[model samples]
Target: MRIYGPNGTTLGAPTGNTRRAGASGFALPDAIATPETRAAATPKAAGNIDALLAMQGIEDPLERRKRSVQRGRGALDVLDDLKIGLLSGNFDASTVNRLRDAAASLKSTSGDPGLDAVLSEIELRVEVELAKAGQF
Candidate 1:
């Protein structure tokens, strides 16, 4: 039997039993007996518990809140500097990158609703400025 190509050219039927070597099947590797493999996987929640325990060592809730506010203020100051530089057309790529880094590094979550709101607004403004400058 013969086969015709799409363009009506005479193409001969497949001629050989063309099963290539190493193409027959796939096999997953046997489980390695390494030390890590032998050890049981730690539960994800175990890490969370450790983090919670570490947080408990903070002791003073008020001090923790104060630190959060201070971090927020520092982030705000960096944003303000970036804004000034942008307005003056004196901003460089490095300054914008630094501002981006600062914005990303901000982990302030002051318990006070008003302060949190202000921090959110400042963060939004920084995002907008970065977007306008095509830095985001």
Candidate 2:
């Protein structure tokens, strides 16, 4: 417990305070920090290629992840192409809406940041390409 004056001046504090028992109930705070530090220092997700290969149930985790990433990138690229076609009056409203929904679904389901970055770079390239082609 701490004692304070009217202006929040520190008067005194009790050294032997057995306050909250719900705080892991450890005698010292450092006792609780060791396990937490170890947990945080290690990766939580199962990403080891060897571990994935040892699984009999999972045929190929790495291959599936790669394919999913590539598929997502392709979907985003197709959407970008459709958007450009719509802006150029080559595609109709329904085509534009379908491509937009496909892009949204890919964004929702994709777990790879690398693929997302690739998609962003591809969009930039498409814009530059369009300018060079005198479309914009």
**Candidate 2 residue pairs in backbone clash:** none
Summed over model 2, clashes come to: 0
lDDT computed for candidate 2: 0.53
lDDT score at residue 19, model 1, on the 0-100 scale: 40
| Candidate 2, 1-136: lDDT as tens digits | 7635433335333234434567566443343343221123343566786877677556465665676677556666665676687689785555445545444444432345776577556555544444444443
lDDT of 1 by residue, 13-43 (tens): 3223334447666443333532222244454
lDDT against the true structure, per candidate, is 0.64, 0.53
What lDDT is reached at residue 116 by model 1? 71
Top model number, lDDT? 1
Residue ranges of candidate 2 with Cα displaced over 4 Å: 1-59, 107-113, 116-136
Which pairs of residues collide in candidate 1? none
